[model samples]
Target: MPSLGSFVLTCIIIAISLVLSVSASVGNIKSGPSPRRFMSGSQRHNATFSLTQIRNTKWEPREMSTTAVYAAEFLKHKVQMPKVLRLAWEKLKLHDDQSSNSSIHRRVDGQLVRYSDGQYVFPVTIGTPKQTLNLIFDTASGDFWVWSWLMPMDMLQNRKYYNGSASSDATPWDGQSWGATYAVGSNYGIVWQDIVWIDAIGVAGNPIECSQGVSNWFASLPGVDGVLGLSYAYNDSEKPEPQQTWITYILPLLAAPVFTVSLVHNGIGTIDFGFIDQKKYTGSIVYTPITIIPGGGAFWAFNWTGFAIGSDKYNRTNIQVMTDTGGNISMMPESIANRYYKLVAGSYKQANGAWIFPCKASLPNFVFGVGSSRIVVAGKNFILTNLPDGINCIGGIQSREEDTYVFLSIPFMQSIFVVHDYGKMRMGFANRTWV
Candidate 1:
């Protein structure tokens, strides 16, 4: 046997190694390729509560600590694209209310609106005393889940967790459980029936997944407590059985069975149910029928007739497109992205796969078609932000060859207003004006 000090030293070495291993694993997720990680697939709207206009629920989005923080934020997007596209080569794939908490948006007209770090969230309250949580309204998925007190200590990042026992209206539901596994890791939880309130009233006996385990990916995002799925078309693949989504419950209660999402760059935005805001956009709304994908599209996927760069005439290059409000940037086929970036002098693809250009490079306007209609995106939006290196800046749009469909996110959305029309099974688009 060895002396006591020698044994203790060996144990310490082993412990340190284990800790570093765990840390490096997480570091890889942050710096490398992982598919679009999802929080909750069951985020649907419920009608039993008062569903009205979301006034001004507010929370900050995840943003870089400083504008010049190199490419950590941009690199993650680049890494996710290849894996996501290779599978689609396989597939694919805000609110306002001013509240004191600043972390959670207060309930309003059934809507939550806040903007930060390029993520849009809505206000949702669960349980009797109304444990409010900030949830991202993701249309690409369908599942409703929130962080729970049951989460492991390490995974809990000082964020809000749903305490089901503290709520008077909480109960077990059908012995069901849900889990969403992602390219990086997985988050799983138990199900409970509780009253969910978005507006003033509450929808009773609604099933919500209380996440007992959270992956480092989801836990790393601040302010985003859960995901509310607006994609009524997609089923919750993680659930033990087919479950009803919140949108299915609330659709019948809507005046026109439609919802609109307006996400403007550097401005207040909202997702309103039942009515459209005419002031948000210019010209009449152009509608395109929802295009079903080859396998299936959980997102509000559609097609555009063509596009034009700067003063160039429109090119009739048709492609399928998907709208993802939670994403910080936009992506397209390498051909189109190359064309767009070429117009910006000094722009070049970086090792991480994102395009970089001089911070002061003149960017050309980008315009894409909505059927016969056309919407112009300002060139400035393409200049995402400056880099820590100081000489260059990252462009908002990136390119990948395997990208089967154009992925539009907050940057593309800043210059346009989008409507997800469930009533007619069509998607609408119109130009947005910041001035």
Candidate 2:
């Protein structure tokens, strides 16, 4: 439970959300007679938009390796050094430990990798007059910074960068500097009090990180400007005093304290800002509280009763999974990965650490527990892509560096309507039917 002070602070933040009059993205961050009114779709569905409306122009697929995308994502969590290992947990413990490190003011969004564009990318407008740049909607990490005019001209090349000075409404955040150092690259910059807009909905004076210098890893992305971070506040990398992410500022203005991601492969997807879109998901939404762990404040860590492969018996092995959409693949226990591949004939582990199987092999469905619910990842989602030979294909689920930690990504997200409820510190999952 949030302390009285935290609840008060949350209300104040939501009050900010309520005040934003942007009619596009935010809708109306209304306070109903009943706080739970929007919890049910009978009330209103606000700010639901398809990816085609916000995404950058799609590019031809690039030649980067899929596992490289996975490795970059794997290192992201590894660098966080989460100390929680998947272990048995009683429902009583779950009830007690829900939302262990909930963000008081957090925001999230994402982008994808691969030239053929395996990931999703969207455009965001910043500054007074507005400079539009394409960015990844990253829900897991917490630094909402982007490329800026402060970097060397050669570094930016022809890529778009934010000119904060050009925005009449931009103001330098006094004495605040920030950095996001990932395994492959780093983005470091000073803070700005500026408007950050996702489509028509904008957060006024949101904390924006404008990078002075970024590594090749970031610059390599064709049209990406930066990340729109939507994780908890503690995960923010600001020094001295941390600032809220863009989504954090947006969260306060929501009709309900929630956001939903509906990811589809090779097709248009959608993101719901404040209300649940019944049209996107089916069945009852199963809720799971964020797991409790020391030194794991930076993730949406949750525990599952167990998982099963295809029609095989459901293994009630209690394991903790760190759900992140920033990355494109999933990583699980080697034992589990081995068992899964055993069921796929001619599957082999390549020197690159990714599992490959004949593209024609029949892959089984992957299912995991969410309370008593069984959420399934269809067999087709498991095969990442056809290799150059067009014979073998990459498997989406790989072996984790840590035996106890399982990372769930595309295979898990593509077919589900994921409700990230920061207010209550629980994640809700509903089966989604992609149109």
Candidate 3:
């Protein structure tokens, strides 16, 4: 008979294999909620009319839930038990030797919702009385900004704006003028410091950019109030003195120096601060070193080994992979994009610079390697649905000519659980339970 430890290890290996097999089989089946419906006639009309007309229209708050589902797959499968047991034993020995030095860590979690525009927004409260606002939890950019009272009335149309005067906790951060430009639009604003709350935890004197004016693209998205940046401090675009990201200020308060995100398609996922929820993922979490950009850590990027589609594998000499929740589709090098689309029948590049194909065209599972681990994104996640008329659908993987970095956007992120480790300067990925 095998030793108890050996038997346990064998069982764990079998369980992990079964879980992976089941996940691979389920990839063929369509799951999760359908894509969001197109904008209403009234919304479309508002888009065409003047900003004043849209501001006059009363905007009712849509029912968006931020409750996350607890995944039971990990408990049922007993995946990663061997590693868990080893870690628990080590911790137990430490506790027995020095109980006073050991400290209990507290984890804070917030619910995240996938907006119609494919961005993940989480609930944030600012001010003394605590006014809750749905802000985009973006890791790509490092600027915490919100729609404020200073903005033009036309710009405030149908969106909630933070009124600093109404909150006793609000304090002006000098007369600082701040401006930031994203792929969407440019926004210039005044800076303010106030009590900001994420779930039950609150951060005092949190820096917030209150926008006074914005570009046309910013005006179009009336649903999103502002952005809560989670990137490093160096990525912050604030002029003169750079401000640290919310994660930086809140790290001391957390039990762990880590944050994890689980983004599911059309369903409520979660952002856990200071700890990783083993329940949300299966198997072991693969950790990859964070690649530093030229100037600084602009985004959570890592060195990508290569990408594989079915039997064909493409190796790259130098590749930087960055994950962004703010973006909808993945962007790769032009050559890679062309090669990927060629694999699908009837897929061709459009004059408008988009790769289009038959809506029903079958695509191979997109797999990318990081370190020694492979992360697989299902084919269903690669099809961008609800395009403008005539264009059936476009490939989710688009081509970018400028940057050497390949962007893994929300479409790819929705398939896995991502961990952003600040202390270790590493990013981790695991197979999501649902996928």
Top-TM-score candidate index: 2
Per-residue lDDT tens digits for candidate 3, residues 79-120, read: 222233334334433443453321110011111212134133
Choose 2 or 3, whichever is better by lDDT: 2
Best prediction by lDDT? 2
TM-scores of the models, in the order given: 0.73, 0.77, 0.70
Q: Give candidate 2 regions above 4 Å deviation.
A: 1-55, 65-67, 79-119, 401-403
The per-residue C-alpha lDDT of model 1 at residue 358 equals: 87
Ordered list by lDDT, greatest first: 2, 1, 3
Give the per-residue lDDT digits (tens) of candidate 1, residues 1-435: 000110010111111111000111111112211121112232333422222222223333322211111222223223334443243211111221233332232221111212133133466888768788866665655667788876776666567778878987677654466766442235667677777776643467767777877644355456567776677554554344546677766675566677877665554466777678787799889999888766543558889999999998899978988776545456778888888888888887643355778888888988999888998887776666555456777676777565477767656776788888887889999987753
Candidate 1: C-alpha RMSD after superposition: 14.7
The residue pairs in collision within model 3 are none
